[model samples]
Target: MPSPIAINPVSPSHSIFKKMSKSPTNLPASAASYLSAVSQADAHARARSLATTVTPTTTPPLSMSSSVTVFSDDNVLREGEPKMFDNDDGLSYPPIPPTSEQVFTTVHSEFGHCANEEYRFTSQHPPGKPVPHHKELDPPYYILLSTYISYMILICLGHLRDFFGKRLKPSAYTHLLPHNGYAPLNSDFDSFYTRRLKLRIDDCFSTPVTGVPGRTIICYDRETQDYNANLHTTGRRTRGLNISSYNYLGFAQARGGCADAVAEVISRYGVSCCGARLEGGSLDLHQTAERLIAQFVGQEDSIISSMGFATNSTIIPALVGKGCLIISDEFNHASIRFGVRLSGASVRTFKHNSMKSFENLLREVISQGQPKTHRPWKKILVIVEGLYSMEGSIVDLPKVLELKKKYKFFLFVDEAHSIGAMGAHGRGVAEYYGIDPRSIDILMGTFTKSFGAAGGYVAGKKNLMDHIRVRGHSGPYAEAMSPPVLTQVMASMASIMGVAPEPPKSANGTSSNTLIPYPGPAPAHMLPNWFDLPPSLKDGTEGLIRLRRLAFNARYLSRGLKKLGFITYGSDDSPIVPLMLFNPGKMCAFSRMMKQRATPIFTVVVAYPATPLVTSRVRFCLSAAHTKDDVDLILKACDEIGDWLDLKQGVGERWSLQEIMDRAVELVHMDID
Candidate 1:
């Protein structure tokens, strides 16, 4: 077997770069100057020399040494002191020239090359400071007024068009109108929002892409000749910087250890399990994954469901019944609402992420008891998402815990976005806030976000989980989670947890390991015998680095946008950053402009029903795979486009695009309410 190679942050040979090395004397003019700047005496001198001469080499050196130490590439000169370069447009390759001594092991498109350790940060709440609540910073009055006016205009125009089209072209309105005897399938009024407002920007949503949605994505180009009702593929493909996909930990890849494990599982186990868990479809893999999930979340036991939404929708009913009351956050996801409705339980909601409002509502509900009957409720369940999807805000768990102690209500935290994306150990919000995971009554999370796999898990006390396994609708109704997905989950999770060194063998040659602690390494016996992971993943080094990189990217982009004077929402450590574009027209404009940039950038825009009317905005999801240079590019693009769209309505002490890019680290560390 070949020896495992040790990859350094400064190594130059990355998968994205072509294998080419130049002698020191034969280096390009830009590369020569960059090297000269690296060895310069002072910061001012280095800046003066690099301003005009520094540019990334199109063909960088390929370092193959087992042990190589070299100056890191791009904006960062070393670990702490990061310098910005403006000479080259890093469309296809890195902008910084790499020395022959540098060797990077990751694929540039899937996992970016970021060697600067100073950029990394731990996503955790500051001890002394209070938890940050979701505070809405309203845009200028004109911006809000224009947003309302834009929606009004769209509605009026759509109604006018519908009236004229129905009379002039009856065939066009046939589906919306009555046929011979049957009533219209969908009334025109019911879908007014979709037909009029959403239809104009239909092209911006549900874009067809051909590759893994990692750092960059390849999108299929399509055109709609007559309105957005029909779209035709143009047979052209554009590779864009992806800020859209929910691949939070940047695990969505086609060529990693996780992918290899998934491929192996497919060949061994085939695809489907062919039946539900209660039937003959139960596999040993499901039980193994469930156990790992429980350990990962610091719970006693957990139940796995085939789908993320189903994990909430089907399991909630099993936990509560007709007499129970579900006090939920107003901004909870649709799945939570669906589950509550099906559970036959009474529901109440408070202002989103406002603990004071929640407490007041809780007091009223507890005092009032069941509606109409005014009798004591059987049980009260408080539900909230660890990370709200649309707003990019985190739940105030500490306050919720305090309230729980006083009020004695069950707590359920939906960590669909927070798991593997937040915290020092990738244990979700509980770890992020320094709270014990077991403190929360139930911890529900999905593998789709961070594990690069399908399905979801709900963890809690062993008895509760056992009951849910047998009683939940998913047990006998839904198809069992397939083998490939289970393998992907186990592989990715093991990489996060990491494998412990083999236990010491007794004189009789029998293993002598007894037990392991929570949040500790996974035992060898837990994984399948056929599983073989790479050294980096086996030791958990790559997983730790990815978590730090994601933290840096999240803070950098969120602070960068705010510094550039764009009204944004979310915590500084949140992976979801939403830049507000109040006008309804700007939603489509922003998405299109970003996609049509010199180096195409894909974005997700939320409007109308997804968010409040005036809060229509473009949401940018940061990933561990994005390098500092990638963030710089996004900031530069937004600065130029923000001015054109008149979207910089934020009131603050602002900085120029260049200054923000240069002082990214300082900005991320800035203390703000």
Candidate 2:
């Protein structure tokens, strides 16, 4: 059998072990078969590069000997390949070879005074932080089944390799395995890291797409360097329809009224705001944007930060401390979780959207009191998302509010995905449920997704916002939002709140509504039954129609996917929809299959670090600008993927477009008001 390791022309055994450590998957194919497959794939990639090359002159072949070493492709592992998990400081390495892409070492921030300190001081966040409050908050059953299976495969492969490599039994590597079958620490890092390692040369993350993220967009495929091209390779760039990106409300267009406002601001203020908010960055635009945001979200006041992630990450730490406890939904965004961790507060997670589980938690906490202390806790914060981005499910805000009343816990609602895409007036979850927005203690949102802008805000009572302004790290430390980004956000908010885009002047100089086209129009049949205005709503503008349209499309598409046999998650009325695809390989395979199709469907694949390794899925976000035809195209594309992947049931297999249309009509009840 051939050795599984890359032929390093160095110590072969050591090279074998090093390569093994970098395996993307734990599945162990026979060494000979694996090597053969790699050889053929490598040969094919080389042949493609050679075929594309226009060699003006030929060079003599270099001499080959036992001393000659062959490097693998950019994605393939070598003895000392670069990776995010690389622990080596690189100081010990030989002089680095020239490379195409810029490679640089990251210098971690170090404090000088600390190295010379004879002084003693104590911080609230000591290393061995809180003795974790047990599953007092987790679901009835917390399972890491896929992760466990993945680890077991790793162990088996290790043992098999040991046996093959002149070892009588499991070698010292076996000693590294967990004593019990189960690992104590539950982390998705290993799975996520390994997955990323395989995708080092893949364009699944953050592929640039032109136009708003709606029905269709032009996704760019940048020129990729040839596998063996040591420096740069001049490859052709291609563009395809993009169905990815989070421009939920159609505000991310390259040319529009809001875009014009952004351009104007960029010209006037230059690119950046130039400093943090508390320093020299504060502008009249910033103040105006904050005021408008507060008014839009029905808040007493609001504070802005340059990033959504930082807003949550920094604000949570400012709000709570050692004495407080944070009760978050199980599947809350990572930023929220990080902020919770940094706060030094005892955190408990309830089953997502489970009111009963949340109440049970409240009862348990109230009954048991604080851990180790048989005394009452200082403050308890209940955090949940208005609409979960991954699951596409809406939180039962009214019920949660009821519980908040019962438990007297302060409620923090993350409206990151809900603000401009939900509620009757798009005031978010509270408005969706016909409840008062002020009932929410802290209203947090981001402009990146819905507003097609950059930055986020924390809005609530005047006092709360004031405290965040003064105490939040973002206000004093982080750079303020760029002027153009700020203006874009402002214009987006204005448009959503019944303000129409200004009529464009025709060549004749008269205002022409014809030139100023209404950006989004909805399918009449897909509109929801509950879309009727209550007495409180005095008017419904073009903006209301757009929101309703988006809400309907999410439901419409979800129903279609489900009827066709594909497993999906999220509320029917939600814009965020996740189609569950379990196999680790299937995630990349599915994405590639869609992109290579005649009509490419651009999709974002989320696995491992973004979710539990077990819950890998392809998230599809619906936008108001996505026409029914676009949604239909996606449905058919997903159908083809299901067929190729051999997913559960038939899904889109048995039906033609006609059948799909029939089902969609029935499911959405097309004969609606």
Candidate 3:
């Protein structure tokens, strides 16, 4: 393992401190009184000042550096005053109110104490002009002013330090503060998706213990070989894929060809990229992966990045400029919004999946007309996701493409949750609807979910890909996608593209040609063992079929819960089946009870920001991987938990399967229209 890098601590220069100590002009009488009151109220001021003297060898905490000290008037000694208390007695008389000269002198001294060596104070005003009233102040007043001034100076210096340190040389503390505000923060700080995903990390690592009769306790022993725990401890798990991950194909944990490919990468490149892509990055493996993605998606070129978030953030800004306009779906992923903001383009958001709203916005843009400004033609980009992560609803690509043709706007589709889960062969929503992949100016997807690796890729025309390579902000500054992992992603893509086998013949006398192979493993006992390809080549065909079955299972489960007198939201066609539990405290209790019964479930308790205070829910994601039996088991568990709570009945109305399917079809039509 490579040794960890050491970071140098920032130390305040003597000159900087000296400048900070310099006195400021007199504050208003009111402000002075307020400062005095504040000083009197803070009991720890003296102790804090004393604590500053004890400097540790390690870097000081930011809070410690920002802490303010309040000095008493007795601390100041004048040259010719009668000492009310002797120095020998360890007591001193309060010094006289500072004169203008004394104030200036004290300020100058404080300034000197706080400033860096490089900082020099030069007065803008002439020195002989009785230093304006604002220029000199009493010691007590000056002290209060100096504290705030010092704080501002420190903040500026910290920014300067970060700027120079990152732009000039490699530093151990480069991660402390960003050199530019736009630069990506540590991944953990920005993503709500990540927060939701972490809920299941503990489950994956849990182990069943032996010799515990009627009690299956989760083991945390080292011998259990909890891979997730090991990965987290060693910082090997760079990407997140928890309960919220849309592993439509169950590739994440399945012991198949995909896992084999991932293992091969681990054997070759170890775990991490170790450095950003621009510097000693861009390995052959990455290039191969990009090629595979481009071919699979029917795109001329592709550029892989660290994550889907970056792919959107980096690409949008690179394609659209100041004169351009971006027409985005209001419900698009947060990453797309951030990217559009960075583009410096005028943005207009259409109602979520509403074609009419999108057309209206486009018409308005068209009416604005070409200006005689620097850019002659007004450019427009339409942004939407192939599938909404939260809603599990597919985008109406054909309708969107028609609008794109009419408006002459570029179409960017984020296929993060759709790729490998839609289309005739799982090519994504565009292909699922039989829409030419070429119609999508840019299509982005992630490898962390269905592909069982970590990274993202943007597929588009050759020119766009070339432009991004040269001009994309994130390409040069941000770290490149990991190479080793790309190999696994590519391998998985190839496997998904491989010919699917035919489903086994049914035991019934009737023979059906519609049944397709299971694609992967399936139990022999499960009826309708064959997976049927959708009849139409339209976009979301595969997704529609899988979604339909998942929805059916969801509705079946919801109906079961309702039969047991529990309330649940969504119909058969909806991928997300939410069980309404009004109280958060009760929701948590219900979750515990479900776990005790060994039926794992997901819950999203309504809190201030996530949802309105009145509506809390136990959200269930219906995956293609989930068998009918799995859905039935979940329903059984819900009943147990609901009965325990005794408030299961009258929670909410249950949605019908037919009603949900009809609603989904309506939503799809709305997007197209």
- Of the candidates shown, which would achieve the greatest lDDT relative to the real structure? 1
* Clash counts for all predictions: 5, 2, 38
Better of 1 and 2 by TM-score: 1
Which scores higher on lDDT, 1 or 2? Answer: 1
Q: Would you list the clashing residue pairs of candidate 2?
A: 392-570, 564-651
Cα lDDT of model 2 by residue, 44-76, tens digit: 545667555332111111111112122333323
TM-score of 2: 0.65
Candidate order by lDDT, decreasing, is: 1, 2, 3
Work out the TM-score per prediction.
0.85, 0.65, 0.51
Query: What residue pairs clash in candidate 1, if any at all?
Result: 11-102, 11-103, 12-102, 12-103, 56-95
Ranking by TM-score: 1, 2, 3
What value does the lDDT take at residue 341 in candidate 2?
93
State the lDDT of candidate 3 residue by residue for 83-154, as single tens digits: 121111111111122322122111110011111111111101122332111111112333335434644664
RMSD per candidate (Å) reads: 10.1, 20.6, 30.6
Q: What is the C-alpha lDDT of each candidate?
A: 0.79, 0.60, 0.49
Q: Is candidate 1 or candidate 3 better by lDDT?
A: 1
Candidate 1's clash total is 5
